[model samples]
Target chain A: MDNLNIGRHISGQFNEDLENVINHVMHMGGLVEKQLSDSLKAVYENDKELAQKVLASDYKINNLEVSIDDECTRIIAKRQPAAGDLRLIMAVIKTIADLERIGDEAEKIAQVALESFDSKQQDLLMNLDNLGRAVLQLLQQTLDAFTRMDVDAAIELHKADKNIDRNYDALMRQLMTYMMEDPRSIPSVMSVIWSARAIERIGDRCQNVCEYIIYFVKGKVVRHTSPDDM
Target chain B: MDNLNIGRHISGQFNEDLENVINHVMHMGGLVEKQLSDSLKAVYENDKELAQKVLASDYKINNLEVSIDDECTRIIAKRQPAAGDLRLIMAVIKTIADLERIGDEAEKIAQVALESFDSKQQDLLMNLDNLGRAVLQLLQQTLDAFTRMDVDAAIELHKADKNIDRNYDALMRQLMTYMMEDPRSIPSVMSVIWSARAIERIGDRCQNVCEYIIYFVKGKVVRHTSPDDM
Candidate 1:
């Protein structure tokens, strides 16, 4: 909040509106974070009830997305936000889209928990959980970076996605080896593959969130920049 | 554009700006369409050069996205447009983001083309080609709907995504069967899986674009709404 210098505005009401929107973003981020965490826990522990709860609660995240979107639109029409303030609104709009997509991925993971898996296939779930946990960490750091608008933390979090990608590749290779050993395990393992893909995408969504934060703070469009260039 | 009624504004300059932005969106959409088409051709024909061309041309789409975003920001600041105009601008902002991601998926698919595959594997590429062509048709129809701001067309296009999803699931099953029949095919088949996923996502991006068109015309948010509800 200090990084935003939100209260320095002459119009206290304008400051309040900005503060409210920012707060709502953080709140929404928290809800999405919880959803993803519960999704991961649901899969690892084979907690179908938790998975059901995660799926049921998805609408709340979706509702928040639409409402926050409306709030930003109202602010734009009322405040006519310029430059930095405008960028902040733009970032919120973009961030919420990514967050909503993240929630969708979480639902996909929760669905994975609902499916029955044999004891042998349980090993694959552990690998997915490893990737899931790494992604959850990335999502947490990303939300923290968004809260502070910390460009440095955002950059670090951005690089961390590569690790998640590497881990995802390793997990994919392992799953393939398992499939090679037992073609009978194909269908169940394919579900794990799908979950792994979703987890990898969550990492991507977090990276996109980090980019939004950097854009809000630095006014730079870092997308499409080669990793080597970065 | 008639559905948009762009020229109704009292300010000719404002109308010009609106028209210019919409035209740019159509231009960008056209470029993305070509990128997707080329990537599909590159894969089916095993044309590495076409794939390379698609990859190289991706930056143009990215650049357009940033510039168009800047233009939308400028318009909001300059016009302070309320109601419909605001919605149009918002839709443009959202649409460009999807278009950019669609370009990313196209890049993924093009990269698939760069890898050499046995003639038997080429049959899998043909299956992927069928999905790719369906998605390309959806993309074409979506762009057409966006250009006209046709709500009915948008609704139809939104429903079209289900067909893409079903096709994707079938493709996944086929890929799984292939891997199960020949375990050594796991690694190579995995790349096809990745490409199919990307193609499915392109279908999703097109659906999102259609949703934007619906939002612009119907003044509604259709996201998170179940199909039965829709």
Candidate 2:
């Protein structure tokens, strides 16, 4: 990841400060990844304690975001970096926003895990587990792509988000069927639906991060650009 | 709101550029406000053409966002303005992101209007209308806060978002009851649920924009700080 090597255009304290900001971003990403993983685990195991822990840890992620944002602003004000350096700070600022929102989504998923669901709905749980694991993998790869500054990898991950969307749609359809068949299960099924929506949104956020990475490295605005064109 | 003027430290082209960006932002806000209103009307009137127009107009909003972001980056690189000036640019950048997202949410609501719902669900539609109007008003007031840089107005709008959340929760409960009473309505009810979620998110995004206005005007990181303290 360090081999990707930004801030080479500037020297001395600017380089060091840039490195610190990157490190903080990667650290925030690590925390968000864990939150997502733990959130799914809580849902799968029905562990209310773990769910509560995920909720409590959100403040740490939020604090990290605020600090990282401050660091970016300070560097910009002090260094007055231009071109690629300016873009790097901008990218980091945007990426942290997405990371913070992803953390919020993870907290929502954890909240759903704390809800009571009938054991008969275990089938729905199994499906949600599959979707959660896939989204978790996408998030992991997206972070790795960020660390590497790998545009190709980022593009690939952008395409991968579509699969998560499909999975979410399929799960929602199945959940709807369950609700239709057993009206008593509507509340629990709705929880699963909400969790699926959160997971799907995480996929979208991961794609946004990937877009930022591509922009940072290639100096191209790949956003709203069709994937096939890339 | 105008009394909360920023970028007073450095005069000339920097101020002009900052003003240009702010004007563009307020212009974008007007577009988003219109989109939200038209989307609600589409749902209420079952007007598919109006919904399609809302969806089509999103590209224009997206283009505006890209251009405003480009202008901000250009100003930072060219001017290298510090302190309050730097913070003002940062606030605009963040605020534009939120505004773009609000446009996306409006598009989602417009998409829901394209879906066919039974006449029996008219009651649910009325509840959604109430929720939609409340969110639109919040968005309008938040934009007004941005234009005026009114910290007090922004703070008041921040508190108002909670009402939208409560209204959303109530509407969801009612929708759930309807779904349970008649399984045949699940598909249409789910569309309403999704649209309502999008509207709820717009309120959140509008609050975020208001927070940025407060930060810009007061140079305070009021986010995550308790409202009681404010």
Candidate 3:
């Protein structure tokens, strides 16, 4: 019943390689999780140094993505895995891509965080911080579901993404109203909107990873399907 | 030298299947191109009908993406392709993903177009229209480069993405100024900004497609590389 047991029936080396790739993916996921957290902290605390660190660490995430992709390519060429194994590799490839993009979004938030605002917008930052915490939780749970190959957990995580979208829409309306009230705060408010967008996108990416987990577990293509049906 | 000649040296059925997938991809690309153009027209003319059509047609694009992905999976499983053949399938998979996301961006723009503006923002729409045209051109050329497997053409298309970024930044500044000048216009301007962001993302997706072309042709990892080095 465990989908994570993929490649167990295959050659020993193939199983080992698959395990290595999964470990690497988990490592990359951990790095991405930290990047998101650091980026949010940078924005909330207005810490330029932390933001700079996020920017610098982005290259490491990028390198990991390329290496993981290369490993997957090598496995496909060498093993010619079919069915479940093939699906796993495809899912990993897709997951790493989403992870790398999440890293990019984090970097964008960091860049915005590094920019100077005329005054600290405490309430706006508080709201963004709450949203960031929610997204981070979704991401962490998605990764756990991936590790456990838990379809139910994956589906639950996928549904959680709707909440992130709703929060994003509400935040956008509030930011727009703030900008309208005081045009002087327009630039700063714009930065917050952009950062929130990056975080919102991370939530979407987490949903994608969850889809992959479900696909790997159930051998079903649940993407683009209505949540009601799910 | 012709990279489009991929899978030519393989089995006849494999070659035929590859051709069919490529044709489907090209067909999908054409549909996406139309979607972008129609969404732009809807915005420029404030035509809700045109925007509605774009939204309605998005499902077709999504279907194509799913079918193409299924075909790729089938090809990999049946053919057990190696080397260049494997790379070709990988590139095709990556390209279709970017193509689907481009469709999503177009849909976002269409959704924005469906929202009613108090008065037509002529100057702003005109600028957006121009930028949209430029992005459309880049997308068309990128698809052409894919069809031809022209590395030089792909490289050229990659360089063109920079212009889209510059245009997006300039347009953001203009939108911000307009919002500052008239607080009442903030909501409409926000929609425009979101739409413009979608267009800008299309440019990024085109760049990704170009990178895939380059990877398939030259076996190079051109992604995340600096333009100066490219």
Candidate 4:
């Protein structure tokens, strides 16, 4: 919020309104980050209770998205902000949608923990733990970049998403090999594959948030210009 | 666009600006729909050339999304639309992002066509064709509802997303059986699995567009209230 630096308007209410929306967005980001981290922990430690916590807590993120969306609409209607203030509001709206989906993907990841894996398949989850932790770090850094509105940090972390994808691809190959070796293991291994996919998607969402960070700060749509270059 | 029934302001330019944005959104929606349809066709006919066309033409949708997004930002800044007009702008902004992702998913589905399928696996692609066509119909209906801003159609089509999910789940179980029965077919079957996942995601994105339609018309966030219920 401090980084926004757009609160020196003649109208005091307008300044407070903008500040509140930004603060609420940060609060929502914190909750989403927590949900993602807890879901990974649930998968890593095989804690059904923690997995249940991840499931039960998702409503919090969904509710925050709705209320914040309402606040954005109200701000635009009441304040009619222009330029940087407008961009920030736009970015907040887009970011919350991505954040909400990230929470959902985390929930998908947590579901894997509820399905019991055999001792051998436990090692597969261990590999998934590695990929999950990598995605978690990407989310953390992306959140920090978003908080500070740091374009350089956003670009740097955007590159880090490639690492997460590489890890996910490697893990997927390993799982396929395991499934082929023992067709009986396909059911359980399939869950691990799906979790890996979820973790990879979380990385993609982080990459999207990073683009929004750059867009808000630089007023440039940096989506296709990334190393993905698409 | 006509169903919006706004844009009768004292400022003549405001009316034109609002109309232009809506028209561009519909145009973009058309391009996205074609991409989804062509991708499915490429898969069904096993036409790599058509699949390649789907891939190459994706940039049109991406570029339209960015341009239309800029138009929304410009309209908001210049016209300061409130109430329904404001909701329409917000809907356009959100709908374009979902539309772009749908393009990406369609591109993913089309990628499956580039790889050759065996005679046995060709039957699986036929099943995928059925699911893909069903999802294509959902997209068409969702786009129609969005253009008209019809709340009832949006709700009805939102329910239709459940049917898409049901088809996807059934197709997935069948694919898993195919893979289990013949483990060596994992690599090719894996592509179909990913393609199926992409098709299902397009349905989810259509469902999202439907919610946006309802949000624009009713000025309510109808996400968590769906039968999927978040």
Q: List chain A TM-scores, every candidate, in order.
A: 0.98, 0.97, 0.96, 0.96
Model 1 misplaced regions, further than 4 Å:
A227-230
What is the C-alpha lDDT profile of model 3 across A44-148, one tens digit per residue? 888999999999999999999999999999998889889989999999999999999999999988887777765547788889889999998998998888877
Q: Please give, for residues B123-228, the per-residue lDDT of candidate 4 as tens digits.
A: 9999999999999898888888887888888888889888889999999999999989999998889999999999999999998898888888888888878565
Question: In model 2, what lDDT does residue B44 have?
Answer: 93
Candidate 4 regions exceeding 4 Å error are A228-230, B228-230
TM values, all candidates: 0.97, 0.97, 0.97, 0.97
| Candidate 2: segments with Cα more than 4 A from true spot | A2-4, A7-10, B4-11
DockQ for each candidate? 0.79, 0.83, 0.81, 0.76
lDDT of 1: 0.92
Best by DockQ: 2
Q: Per-residue lDDT for B45-100 in model 1, tens only?
A: 99999999998999999999999998999999899999999999999999999998
Candidate 2 residue B40 Cα shift, in angstroms, is 0.5
Error of 1 at A90 (Å): 0.7
Give the Å error, residue B117, model 1: 2.7
**Fnat of each prediction?**
0.84, 0.76, 0.68, 0.55
Ranking by lDDT: 1, 3, 2, 4
Clashing pairs in model 1, backbone N/Cα/C closer than 3 A: none
Model 2 agreement with the true structure over A121-140: per-residue lDDT tens digits: 87898899999999999999
